[model samples]
Target: MCRLAMKTASKPFSPFSVLEAMEAMQEGYDGSGLGLLLRGLEFAEYKYNAKDPILSGIAHSEAALARLNKIMIEAGFELKYDHEFDVKRQMIEAKDRFKYILRVYKQSATWASLSAEEVENRLMLTRLALRKDGEAHGQDLTVFSLWPDVAMIKEVGWPLGVGQALGLDSGRITSRICMAQGRQNTNYGINLYACHPFFIQGVATMTNGENTAFIPIKDWLSGRGFPGYIGYQSDSEVFAHILHYVTKQLKLPLETYKHVITPLKNEELAAHPQGDFLRGLRDACRRLIIDGPNAVIGTLPDETSMLVMDAKKMRPATVGGKPGEWAIASEMCGVDAMIPDRDRSKDFQPMREHTVIIPPDRQELQIWSQFDHLPIHQAA
Candidate 1:
């Protein structure tokens, strides 16, 4: 099993707060690896450069770094600001392999002339091309994300130790939302690309539990002819892709995501008001149905955060906090560590049939059930 924690607030706070919550649940996960995704960045420079895309990754050598620069330049991207972590050798494992990088880039001169859809497609394609070139030459270059106001850091080591090495403990890397995972290596080897909080376009997700239906879902996603869906380093990566496909590609509402991935049974659908529409969706997205004992936490491009559970609800998770602040975690201990003063009486543990949603405004939490009525016109 693995541990997951998320922190969201109306204003930006240090990423260290989320790491501290993960530390509280250390017993649930081994110190194999740590992955973090920070969105709604509050860096001083980002205030003025919010439109630029920020590239986050790790380069194994100087040659790999040079190659990345060359690729970005060739793709019509201009470097704006570069921020590389001063990784502490003594604090982290595998000192030789952790050259962390975060750089901002301005799009090409013609970027302003493209449609919204065209710009999104270009960003994803460029990131995929960079990943392919790096892998082909064994450059040990990994690109985690290329989006505005988002930064992802992943490394192998204890949660806090890795956070310290990445300079997260300094309380400077702040964001309005942060999702992190303390990975417990179970099936796969420790590969940095296989870390949690997988990202594509603007959709990001991190999950706990093995996805038994990974291959089928991955195949369906790749066949859709999208370049960003190529990497399948982790079974859970498909969760993010599935989200991107449903919301971005298909242009569906956020609630439709839960319907696609964990559809209601025929019997359960019969009880819903939009049974006919749901039945049709179930048939159309059959291959995307996930089968496994998993709990997922993710954020949408608009900053909406969600916590979802599989039909069986085998994994543990909780959501708690007061107004203007909230936290979701794999265990209650993690929540307590983040906001001890929260109203314990109002804490919620979503059942197998529920999806807990917190909109970008951070005002209230909405719990939508699989049996809830969805307007057919919204999906139409």
Candidate 2:
């Protein structure tokens, strides 16, 4: 019922380690689903070349792949390269097997000068089009994410099988950041989209607990006029979107996300010197407030990994590792599984009052607290 994310140095390491960590925490989650998100992929053949859009998801059949490609071509995107992942290792049975795997598309010469925002818009629309077409034609098309340097793999089964199907080995697959979730089936049906490590644009997130404030949060986000906000397959997906909304759209610093979603009470805010700013932030983004025992693990656009918990600290989270490498998980055992030789004495969990931030390729952890004398944005 929880989610875990591992952010390492820029160097690529096999996702096998992530799978191992997930396995160590298997008792905490059901075998319903396993979701993987990889950044700084080491699979040279499918390695990201530029800001080109890399689309990851499932296709029902070869015909569905054709339809997806046609939709992209008609929209003016040219296929610079297409590489389907080797699913020879897919050992588990499921309602649907993935066909027509990962594809990376380059912008056509005509649209070569397009801005990153334009490319993102095109990617979102193309995904939406594919989903719509899938519905109309009875095809199953699920797009996990479309962005640079990131790819997602998800399946409805145990972590071991999902990892095997991915053919993950130190030699075969590697990434700087890999997030995997072993589903426990708390709120929704076992659907592909409901899997953890939900992603949008370049940001990704996975959660270990429920967001009791899901309904209002969903309503508030859906009204934002962004087509990408339409789907809420997993209630926890809102954490990812909220990260996107606050950091991307609201033009706020990353630490502000912790403040908006789990703001302190008025009395607690009064303890800070910049209480006025904190109060204004709470009032402005009140609709985005999240309630209950939730722990969120996510990556920012800059590739920094974040860990935060709600005020109640209902779920377990441990942060540990040496410099240039760090991991945040729902349990200390998961961290121990990944870095068994690390100093366990130094291992620490973020108190409900602090948010943990790990920068890419570095281990200078920053702790942002609500009771700090500085404003929330300046707390980090």
- Which has the greatest TM-score? 1
Local distance difference test values of all predictions, in order: 0.86, 0.77
TM-scores of the candidates are 0.96, 0.93
lDDT of the structure predicted as candidate 2: 0.77
lDDT of 1 by residue, 305-378 (tens): 99999888889899998888999999999999988999998999998878899999888889888777664475
- Model 1 scores a TM of 0.96
**How does residue 15 of candidate 1 score in lDDT?**
86
Off by over 4 Å in 2: 98-100, 373-380
Q: How many backbone clashes are present in model 1?
A: 0
Per-residue error for 261 in candidate 1, Å, reads 1.6
